[model samples]
Target: MSESSDRLQRRSAPKRLTADDWADAALAALAERGLAAVAVEPLAARLGTTKGSFYWHFANRDALVAAALARWEEVSTERIIRAMETAEPDPAARLGALLRGATLSVVDDPLEVRLLAAGDHPEVAAALARVTERRIGYLAHLFELLGFPAPEARHRGFFAYTSYLGHAQVAHAVPGAVPTDPAYLAAVTAALLKR
Candidate 1:
């Protein structure tokens, strides 16, 4: 083909998908189903693309899984902490806000619970460990700012994190079992923030 013909063909071609696009689709699959659902062909079909698009961004399914996990960690943990820090000025209030938000929110796909169930997978396990530590550490810092000593702060942080995990699991596995009303959320926050 002539150079002009080649240029025209390239210009008319479909836009290439980015790695983030693949990672996001993979994460949606992970959240909806499980780690097992993050296969290349299925995700490609979901994205209305081909396996060639998947291979262009990720070496294999494991790499795609890792990328999805990383995106989840960044979105679910890091950005949340940042938002909490910015949104609340008082430490105790921040902790309470965190509790209320976490408890009252309704998620269609329980990504955390799904990842926890898939914890046996190596990528999921590693990502879970990192997110667990980071979340608990941030909670501990907030507790410390609220006047709790380091050890006490850490313990309370762990307790708070576990409470969130339990809430997520209950909300996902058995909807309507846990009360998500404002009164219930307030009670839970009051109990958690009790000195």
Candidate 2:
């Protein structure tokens, strides 16, 4: 083939951005700037593409939003739970790791904070409910394994989840209000796990 023809072919073949690519970009926009910023044009520009590419993958903005929320639920909640269950055998140690990780990574990971802010939307609310239930249930199971009665286990799980939510709010809304130092995090985790 001629050099010019080859160049033309390459230029005409726009990058093939997959549906997952668009979905992930939408989630990032949602996390960084909230649900309003997940619009196609904005995400297309962010991905260095055009609306045509977005439409090629998603049917509409609502579809894209649904995909983004599903991705968030899978990545943020399900994956973490799976990893915790597989990687740690001891309930106490798994709980400690979870509590410490959640506390320490608050500022660095604000997707949950962003989602909570947008929870009024139907899709966001549904996803939030599912994740909250799953997380709290898992925490409760861990507490149960640690020998707490069912009711106490459930309450502790709720408390731990709420504590993380509060800590995340402080860390995200007012930096430096919550100390994420190693010692501080360890102390907090120990306190949570204390019988």
Candidate 3:
């Protein structure tokens, strides 16, 4: 092979980028340039790799989007579900605790907030809706554990999900917002939950 051909082949050989690494690079690209900038070509370039690597790991753009949504769910919705599951289990206190834990967890995690805030893409929105529904169902189950009637528990669960997401939306839109204050959020959530 010619010298140029050899160099090109060596450079194009797959580099090791884990799912987490690709996600991280994609998140950074999302933050630095916004959602439109997160196309696979740019993401691949950002990872010091190529589009072939992305397809090798994911089925298509839809699949990659699902991965991003899954990661967001892991950090955001899953945290809430896990917190509710492990906390005191009194519906009110558990709800408060989940919000508190999630609020604390959000400190400086802008990418997490941004991804959660993205309800624009139809696929992302669908994935998030599924995650949110599961979370609400879990919350309803938690309420049933606390003596709430079946229907009431279901309504409350949906309400809680909406409230938390609403807060996330507000947090994402408010420039210079920080999750440094626990007492305020806890107090706010506690008051809000009791209503």
Candidate 4:
């Protein structure tokens, strides 16, 4: 090795990356580069670290993937669920507020927009489908409690749920899409709530 190379190698510090670091990098990679680009080397590079640090923090790639999903569930789904649950005594109002807040937040996530646009990430696809299903179920229950028949409640809930997904796509796709705007979102949502 050249003198400078030898000196640089000798001067390298020991790796000290933690699990949270790896998870953060992994999440960013998933949201930005799509899942395929999130291998150990790239994530380590994104972290300004190395693969050794990743292996130390994660058992393998799957573990990292699980961690990323868990983090999303914690911050996104769980938080929204809590907010809606606590919003009010009225289910419609509470769910509406939650959906409105969610739409607004999702509008700001360009990375999420791109990731969904790319159509990769089977894991996220499956997980989000489940999340959507649960949300639809919640809507159904709420409508039922509001005095609608079960079938009608489910029908309206499905309509609202699907509309939200479509609106989310538009919000992420159109250059100036802002379906998340509170007043606009309320108007759109109020229109959809009709059976």
Best by lDDT: 2
Model 1, 91-188: lDDT tens digits are 88898888877766634457788899999988889999999999899999998998889999999999988988898888888987888778887887
lDDT sort, best first: 2, 1, 4, 3
Q: Could you arrange the candidates by TM-score from highest to lowest?
A: 2, 1, 4, 3
TM-score of 4: 0.75
Compared to the true structure, candidate 1 yields what TM-score? 0.89
lDDT of 2 at 179: 83
lDDT of 3 by residue, 63-158 (tens): 776676677667557765775567575666776777666555554455555655566878667876788788889878866776778888898778
- lDDT (CA) for every model shown? 0.86, 0.89, 0.69, 0.72
Clashing pairs in 1: none
Q: What TM-score, to 2 decimals, does candidate 2 have?
A: 0.90
> Per-prediction TM-score, please?
0.89, 0.90, 0.69, 0.75
TM-score of model 3 (CA atoms): 0.69
Put down candidate 2 lDDT per residue, 1-195, tens digits, no spaces: 999999999999877899889989998888889989999988999999989988888899999999888888888888889999899998988998998887887778788899999999999999999989999999999999989899999999999999999999988899889987788878876776788
Backbone clashes under 3 angstroms, per model: 0, 0, 0, 0
RMSD of each: 3.8, 2.8, 6.3, 7.0
